[model samples]
Target: MYDVVIVGAGPAGLSAARMAAEAGLKVALIDDQPRIGGQYFRHAGVRRIGGILAPRFGRARYIHTSLSTLGRCGVEVLNEATVVEISADRTLTVAFRGSITQLQGENVVIATGARERVIPFPGWTTPGVIGAGAAQNLMKASGVLPGSRVVVVGANPLCLLAATSLLRCGVKIVAVCAPSRPRVTFNALLRLMRRPDIFLRGVGYLLMLKLYRIRMLSDYRVTDVIGDAKVTGVITRRFAEGLPPSEERLDVDLIVVNDGLLPNIELASRAGCEIEWEPSTSVWSPKRNADFETTIPHVYAVGDCVTASGVENSLLEGEIVAISIAASKDVGERGRLRRLSRLKWRWRRLQKFRSAVVELTVKESLDQRPLTDDTIVCRCEDVSLATINDALCQGVQDLNALKAETRVCMGRCQGRTCMHTVLALLATAVGKEPDQFKPPVPRLPLRPVKVGDWLKKF
Candidate 1:
């Protein structure tokens, strides 16, 4: 048994572990990835990919330092360990190297991070079309460029950053398309200025695009991807409230798209933590107290898993949760209460910037052109929008009923990619809010495991 078992090795988990360890508590940090850094910090330094942009992608020194500190402070780090289940008793069932083991933690921290929210469009499953996050991972972790020529599509600022990164790697960017209006972007910018570092990074990305003379198409949405087996190009339309939409076709080998991000709340949900729906992002997150503990006693969540705010917020939250956990043991701390107060204050202040980012990235995108009936909603099951619509029309009013009707969320992903979209459509069809409809209960064995391996564990 450990004092605390943090399920993630990203900034939040690392910080939490370090703080807990230093407070004289035995801490264990587990992550599914072979490496410690979570998505935001993974290959942050271009270890696998070497190019002119290599310096920009080099491993983050802070993460490196954090790793060393964790080791020095006697915090156990378990990489390639997937936590499949969490019990109310604070026991974690983890699968690693084809075997399963139970770990009991006096306190548990779920920092599983967030997943890329992909908005399915026609031909999105085409060979050359990829999520912006996937493209980033491919380039940074595997040293593979997503494509020679790419058109980045999304309203999120990450799209702009991805475009710039691809440009730095000598990839010819066709254009950057965002569905956001100029007015919304301007307002977001004003709010962004409160956090100058983030605001400056965004501005730098845009400036880079301008310097390259690449088109930055505002209020433009990709209506269709023009390709069969592979993406050949995309069809974009500039949408305005009153004016007729203007259509343009861009020829490109690759299409990178991002909607935004949604927190990975499956573990918490499975642990029976109460969830709260956020209207801004149209996603549910495990509810947490100011101290970061969830409704489940001694269970906590932090980082992007709580809110896809940013790395800065994640790091701060990690520290806060760790401190809060440490205080329970009557750990020696010179200014425990004072520091916690300050961190909470800083965290609350950062919410303004986070809200602005959500508004800028998601507000317009959610109002996107309705998906065509033929558009695939569930890629794994090949369930189409028409099928889901028909099911709703048949009076399938609940998530489970809809799933049973069309097998929409019953595929390999088990609704990770398609559930939000389906839920939104269902809520709209039923004339109810998303929270009014209950989401399917999260089941155990969250990740796929072989029956043979499962038997061996027993």
Candidate 2:
């Protein structure tokens, strides 16, 4: 059994592993990705700048040193390892590569990170439509552009970053549809002033937007994705407009939507950790104490899997959680407290730096109900809004009941892609807050794992 088993290789997981191993703990870092850098540290064959703030000059160089530290510190790294399930006794059933393996850990740190929140619209399932974050993922991981011409929609700041990257890749951005009106834009710019580094990055995006002559279609939301077989265009309308809104169509091969992100907390919830839906962020996060420990005694939640503040905060949180684990292991309480005190100071400084980022990057929800009534809310099950509405009309009061009635989230994705949309529709129909509804039931095999693979190995 290892002293610490980290479930992601992102900023948080890497930092936690390095620190725990440096403290003389046997560390095993697991990630589904093929490389150490998670989605945030995706380096595609060149020097990567931006994202990570390091003294090493470039992100590529920083990642190099991080992997070097994990190596020199003797952390056993398992790339392409998918943690399928966690048992009551802290045994992690991991599907690594072709076979499955059982890992018993003294302490488990979950840093699975976050996934893009995509609001469904008519024709969003078209071949060329993608999440703006997914578009960036494709570009960052493989040096690929999403499409020749793209229409980026939604209100998240990730739209700005993806647009900048796509432009650098020589992709033509037809338009960027977001709620960038005067008051909201001014507040974001003014609020971001406290963080000079972030302000400069925002300026860089604006400069690129100006340079490329891309339309910053302010206050706009995608009403519908207009395409038959593939993405041919998108219909955008202002959010503040009247019923039967004035629509503008933009012809493009790709439609990248960036609504927001939800913490990937399936594994944590499946492990019986308490979860609370945070109204401020409009995302459900694993409930953690001040010590960052989950409800499970030896399990800890850190990074974007807990809160998607930023990379710097995630790195700090990772270190803090590692200290918590080290302290709990009956390793000289006095010495552990002394080192934990030092790490907490670093954590405070990093948290202060990210406070402005959280304020400026809060996403606004869109009215996705009027999307022609036939939009596929759950792509995995092909469940449409009409189907959900029909179920609601048939006396489905609870969200879980509606799921049973319509098979809304009983799909392969396990409600990752469309749970929020389903919740929103039900909340509006029931005349109650979305948080008032119960969360989707958490199940074992949090991620998809074949029975044969585990039977053969474990």
Candidate 3:
């Protein structure tokens, strides 16, 4: 048993563990990855790969310090431990390689982070269409180039950053395509006007594109991808009001598409935590109070797993949640809370800039292109969109009923990927607003548990 068990070793998880352990709480940090850096701090030694960009100076140093602090503070870090289930009694079932174990904790912090959102278009499943983040992971985390010539497609500030990084690593960027208008949120635009340095970074990226002569395609989308076994090229079309159909085919070895991201809320939902759906980010996240405590007592969540906020907000939330937890234990620690209050002020100040950028970049809605009847909406079970629509037309209004009829959300992913699509289709079929419809009902074994491994639980 431990005082706190953190279920991820990313920025938020690491920050929480570092703070909690420093406060003399026994901390256990578990992550499924082979390393503790998660996605943001991903590094693959000294080998340089095409399209890989180095991290920012401050971020690099902070990650180094955090890792060193973890070692010095004696926090138990399990790198490859996959948490399978969480019980109502705070019992955690984890699978580490061939072994299964049950652990208990007084407080549990979930920072499992978020996964990249990949909206399937025609031929997206072909060999070369991959998530923008997946390309970054391949080059930065694993030291392998996704492809020599890459087309970066998405609508986030990160997509631009990824393109810049890839260009720096000597990869040829065929083009950068975004479906949304090239506009920032009003608040973000105001903040950017005040911050010249941040404003210059955007200009710098454009200058780099000009220097490299890379093409920038805004108000465009990858309508169809063409390939056989491997990607040969991509088809892009402009988005105008009933514009004439003219497809621009770009020859490319790889295509990276990032729609946005969704929080990994499977475990939280299965553990019976209340979920809040945010249409702006198109994600279902846990409902937490000002103290970062979830509806379930002693369970906390921070980082991108809670919102679409980036690394800075995640770290700040970690500290805030840790301080709140500490204050709850010792109400007399006024000094600690005071210091934390100062830290929160600084965090907010820094976040004023980042929140603006995220607000400008996050995907607010699904791809408006209608799904084909033959398109597979649920990739895990190979369930077609037509089957789901058919079920919905037959009076299956609720997600549970749809699940029973079409098995759309009953696969290994546990409805994370298909829930949004299914809900949208159901709403369209039933002529109801998506929010007005019932949300997805979560089932058990939230994390993937192999049958052989699950049998050992007994």
Candidate 1 lands at a TM-score of: 0.95
Cα lDDT of model 2 by residue, 338-388, tens digit: 777887886665555455555555365536435767878889989887889
The pairs that clash in candidate 3 are 51-166
Which candidate has the highest TM-score of all? 1
lDDT (0 to 1) per candidate = 0.84, 0.78, 0.77
Task: Estimate TM-scores for all models.
Answer: 0.95, 0.90, 0.91
Candidate 3 lDDT (Cα, 0 to 1): 0.77
Error of 1 at 361 (Å): 2.8
| Model 1 alpha-carbon miss at residue 366, Å | 5.8
- Stretches off by above 4 angstroms in model 1 are 44-53, 182-191, 362-367
**With candidate 3 superimposed using the best TM-score fit, by how many Å does residue 100's alpha carbon deviate from the native?**
1.7
Writing each residue's lDDT as its tens digit, candidate 1 over 1-458 gives 99899999988898888888887889999999999888777784454444544535644787778878898989988899999999879999989888888899999999999998887877787889888888888877777788888999876776777888798888899888877654466766677777888778787888898999998787788888888988888999988678798999999999998888889999999999999987888779999888999999899999999888878898899999988988877884878878889988888878878888777664543336656889898999999988988999899878888888999888888899988888888889889877886566678798887788789887
**In model 3, which runs have C-alpha deviations exceeding 4 angstroms?**
50-58, 184-186, 192-203, 242-245, 331-334, 350-355, 362-364, 437-441
Model 1: per-residue Cα lDDT at residue 250: 94
Q: What TM-score does candidate 3 get on C-alpha atoms?
A: 0.91
